[model samples]
Target: MTSIITHNDQELLKLIGERQNHQAFEVLYQRHFDAVFRYVFKVMQDRETAEDVVQNIFISLWKKPPSLNHPTLLPYLFGAARNQIAKEIRKNKWNKEQLDFIENTKGICSTDEYLEERDTRKLLESGIQKLPQKCRNVFKLSRFSYLSNKQISEKLGISVFTVENHIKKALYLLRQSIEFIVICLVSWY
Candidate 1:
């Protein structure tokens, strides 16, 4: 393993750009392998997928090592990882849609359905802050605090029915709020 220069990752980039500095590439790989793997694993959730992404990322690096205007390779690698994650997510989503379309001729969520579902979920997550106090508390317990309704009942010293109602109302309010946001977005756009 080569020691990283105190400053300037471009040392390796420069070498690779000027001449086919294979050793410099080796140095770049060693320095960046762990970080790249960590990044892919953070996104992909599967070790095998992460490993494959890392391999692809490096293969790209070698295919065209560096140009005079090359940006810092470190950020470029991570940015590429982010793009790969998005691509993988979208690919899987489309695959699921394809399966659903084949299996259910009567009804299927189109691309709009998936986008709206995702946006609604995002809105609900962000708008929980605006829920009525009791409803918000129950929602947090069930979703974030990871408490069963029975446990929530004990903790809040409320009837089980009340806890259940709180959860129901919370969900209703969340859905309504998200719907409102979606409507607003559509109107504005």
Candidate 2:
């Protein structure tokens, strides 16, 4: 019998999907756990939560392995980790620092590295356009114009808290929108 360790990710996935092969599942888990865990840990900044998120990712994969045309599962795994981290951030109401951390980490994987810079810029612009008028204005002022929260508040005649809230909402919405696009792009390639 051929060793499952020699099988590629697609073959392993097929084994798991069609035969419910735990060994194949274990192979995949062992192959990806460290990279996925490291990514989740970096973004989460909490070992236990990161482990939980990574564990859930593998659990979901084991439960229903996705049918992918691609040979490698790295993109899918990274994408799953990204989504899981985002969900955790939203659920836990993590601070902006964590959000920024995830944003910076997006290009750490090969999947995101393949995105054209111009395409990413366009998607970000589109997401910004989709924001509410005031929120959009605040985001632009803060991000584009390099204005501080106090400066944005004074210019918009809103309180600093309101300005901060607008920026957060804009970021949350933009992140969701851009993440969806990135996922589609990853699946495409």
- Per-residue lDDT tens digits of candidate 1, residues 58-165? 787777765534434565676666666656666776345433333343232334544565576567778788888888888898775557899999999998899999
Q: Report the number of the highest-lDDT candidate.
A: 2
Off by over 4 Å in 2: 111-189
lDDT of 2 by residue, 80-144 (tens): 99889999999999999988887876756564453454367678899999999999999999876
Candidate maximizing TM-score? 2
Question: Please, what is the TM-score per model?
Answer: 0.42, 0.56
**Candidate 1 C-alpha RMSD relative to the actual structure:** 12.1
Checking candidate 1 for backbone clashes, the offending pairs are none
RMSD of each: 12.1, 14.5
* Residue ranges of candidate 1 with Cα displaced over 4 Å: 1-7, 66-72, 94-189
Worst 10 residues of 1 by lDDT: 100-109
